[model samples]
Target: MRTDHMLSMIDDFNGAGFEQVDLMAPIQFDVSVRYLKEDPWERVRQISRRLPNSKVRALIRSRNLAAFDFLPHDVIDAWVDRLVANGVKVIGAFDGLNDIDNISRALVRAKEHGVETFGAVSFCESPVHTDELFVAKAQELIEKADVDAIMLKDAGGLLTPDRIRTLVPALKSVMGDRVLEVHTHSLTGLAPLVCLEAVELGADAIHLSVAPLSSGNGQPSTQSVVRDLRALGYVVNVDDERVDAISNRIREIAEEEGKPLGEPVEYNGLHYMHQTPGGMLSNFKSQLETAGLSDRYDELLHEVARVRKELAYPIMITPFAQFVGTQAVMNVMAGERYKVVPNEIKKYVLGYYGTLLAEIEPELREKIIANGASDIRLEPSEPAPMLPSLQERYPDEDLDTWLLRAQFAGSQVDEMKKTVAEGGNADEIPQPYFGLIKALYEKSEDGQQHLKFGDLAISLDKSK
Candidate 1:
């Protein structure tokens, strides 16, 4: 989670009416990196304890975590000790992994610490969203990884409903109650509808934001899904009045931070797909204000993938790509440092400088080409890909033994820790990146003071 990350504003739900809701025990949440390690006793830290202390959970990440290797074993052990100490159960996170063996090893550690663990990785091989491979991966996680549950995530919002209808059931057939949660996005305007479809088809839970905070570019809408799920006869326990109060409080916080709510929303089915969990404070769209390549970003991302295939070492689309989507494409293919305006970068990728043969991921671009897809769409739905040690260099390494650091979803740790650190990597943050993350933390009094790390300025890479 980002330093500015905080729990869902559901503090208002801390009353008796919660019994009226029939949701499952495990739910999804957002947390600050701080509460996870530095101050387990912080007010935000208690959100889990209040979630009926039952079945609510969340995705854990840091704005810069994608660049990190697996957590040091000591760090992982310390977090497990804390969660168990707090009565927290079923922990999960991604980022920081050299390979699948280490991921499985982390899960085993969580189990030993008396908490369930789950892991997510993009089907980086293909952009076509489906559960075909995820179902198999999730099953392997349960029996092979010893994970109590598996949660699929579409971090970039690149899934389709047709895929969900076909895949959710397949996953249920394998993981059963063990495949407990589903994380998806609104990139295609199918978040809420697709979520209901997934639930009826067999998904046990979904990740959502209660408000339109960062609606368009993040995960599904929590409130809209709760409302629709109730209509569909699935039990979702949310207090409408309490939800209203929570939204109001969130609004006050947004006002304090000088964040924009993105053009006024006109609620509709596609509403959830537009959720911006990071946008709780601001939107990524505004970040691209000057990039002038906003019109070309979608195309540039695919081009970048093409370049990665030629390099052939399961590489990733860096966070830099999220901001300068077009430039990042050129960055990867140049094979060395180079610069270009966003659109120039976009045009060049399409018109020059790439090994088109290798750039097109046979696994990814092939599928897109097969579907006759010209441009790509992103969704947040990810089912585990059930591949085991496809290229394990050392099978003898104990799958259950390795180091891991526990960074809970939405938790902030650096500032909260004993050290007072500063650097440029901390500055020039990507907008949709930590720029939005910081704004949301400035909302409430507690959050405002909480993120007050003196001189910890985030220099945005010029607005998009």
Candidate 2:
């Protein structure tokens, strides 16, 4: 979630008389690199301080430990410790490939910090991704990793009703009364249906967002889901009145700020092809437009599929998504595939980020190697620790601040500190509606702004 959305969701939850709400916080690496230039945890700390009753959880990329590169045990430990200290009560840890080694270490650290862990099976579609595979993965998370629960994390919204019906039951059978949660997005327009099917098959919880912030590429609507569940004779604990109020407020704010409201998108086959998350797609569009190649957006989308396959079908999430999308953009713009392979991709092909579930084609692997990709000479045993250097740089700062500086650029940390020192909460600031009206007025040649509401028309003159 974005910082502003996190703040607003907390406020909405409190106002709605809810005693607790589970928040799926974004990964720190994603926030620092993709979302914000500064320390993203500043807002997290604020929210945690304000909402004592709410449970804040973070999504962890098990192998990378919230980074593009594989991090050492000490770095992982420090990251988990800081997150727990700041606000995160639970960590939903998962590997892009269902590699137990990738997740077990992080889960152990999370437990050491007294943070609950939800081991996840990253849902995808391929010959390797099957109901049996997920069931076995869930069992491993329970028996080996000792996670408190298991989450079927469908990052790509690839779960269909038929698949959910079979998969949910299989997972439950292996879980043997362990808690099961379903988390999926609406990219393929099947999340709501899949969510219902999961619940019917005995999922303990479902991740949802309030309307206006729900649907589209986001989660299914909490209120709508509640309604459906109740209609099916299931008892839901949420307050309908509060849900309505929160939705209304969100709608108002979206309108005032000219932000797009969450609406159902028609099922686009292209989404299935590339499996790019909604936010990543938006980022790709923005980057392409800035480069004056927005006209090739459709072409770029097609390239993503080819690139992903060539790279051996990386689960379209996080660092991998960025890596594949970036390489695709480069390929499209350069008009030649694999002409400029990123360092991350090179490292990936060399098994730095853990073994790929499927093999990269022999020809493609050789091509990547021929094009300057080489195996990094790091320890074959484990990732190198980053904390020692981090400690050296920020000798005086506490762990939380040190971690922020370590993850983000120093200037971003300074800017964040300045913002906090100035007693400014960017999320709390309302949209400048009057400034928008003034801009509209300025744009009108006659010094009169014309407005239309359905068939009704009105005019506002500067003189008046």
Best by TM-score: 2
TM-score for each of the candidates: 0.57, 0.84
Compared with the true structure, what per-residue lDDT tens digits does model 2 show for residues 292-313?
9989888989999888887878
lDDT of each: 0.45, 0.76
C-alpha positional error of residue 384 in candidate 1 after TM-score superposition, expressed in Å: 29
Candidate of highest lDDT: 2
lDDT of 1 by residue, 1-464 (tens): 22233344445655413422211111121122223232333332455565662443433432122222223444444444544555555666543111344356556666787666676644332332235556655655676567766666665444557767776777778765565566665654656676788788877667766564535655665567777888888766666787677667566555544555422223343222221133321323443345554564444444545443332322132332232333334454443423333422332223222112124334543333333223322321222221133115325422221111123322133343332223223423422444465566545454332333356543322222
For model 1, the superposed segments whose C-alpha errors exceed 4 Å read 1-10, 16-44, 48-67, 95-99, 119-130, 262-299, 308-464
